[model samples]
Target: MKFAQPLWNDLKCQLQDGFILDTSWTNIYLPNAQILGIGKDITAHKQSKQVLNTQIEQEKLMRNIA
Candidate 1:
């Protein structure tokens, strides 16, 4: 299956440590809104992918060498 690209709407910052994530964020429409964020740590997944890619490239190089 195929899908269109996603819309990019995330703003990056350490908001809570100081404040917009520089005075403070204001959402006047939702005056009582509280924000919560969650994320996954993909270090293991990324390392495994890198190892697999390295092996694939080594095999390709060996084939060309032969």
Candidate 2:
């Protein structure tokens, strides 16, 4: 596949075992053709973001009531 084409992309993917991954991918073709990728476990970050959103909504409601 690398020999045919070179490309890069960033995506969030879920594995077959039901795990999620945040991926950063890159392809290079200069001295040699290479494909590189990296990922992080962002489950905690996602949960934190949801909690923050919920807190923001609650704050908004409280301000309106007051």
Highest-lDDT candidate: 2
TM-score of each: 0.47, 0.57
Clashes of each: 1, 0
Over 1-66, each residue of candidate 2 has an lDDT whose tens digit, in order, gives: 445564646577889998877655555555565545444466576678899999999999999999
How far is 20's C-alpha from truth in model 2 (Å)? 5.1
Residue 24 in candidate 1 has what lDDT? 22
TM-score of 2: 0.57
Count clashing pairs, candidate 1: 1
- Global fold similarity of model 1 (TM-score): 0.47
Off by over 4 Å in 2: 1-31
lDDT of 1 by residue, 1-66 (tens): 453443323343544655332112222222247533334344455568889999999999999999
Compute the lDDT for candidate 1. 0.51
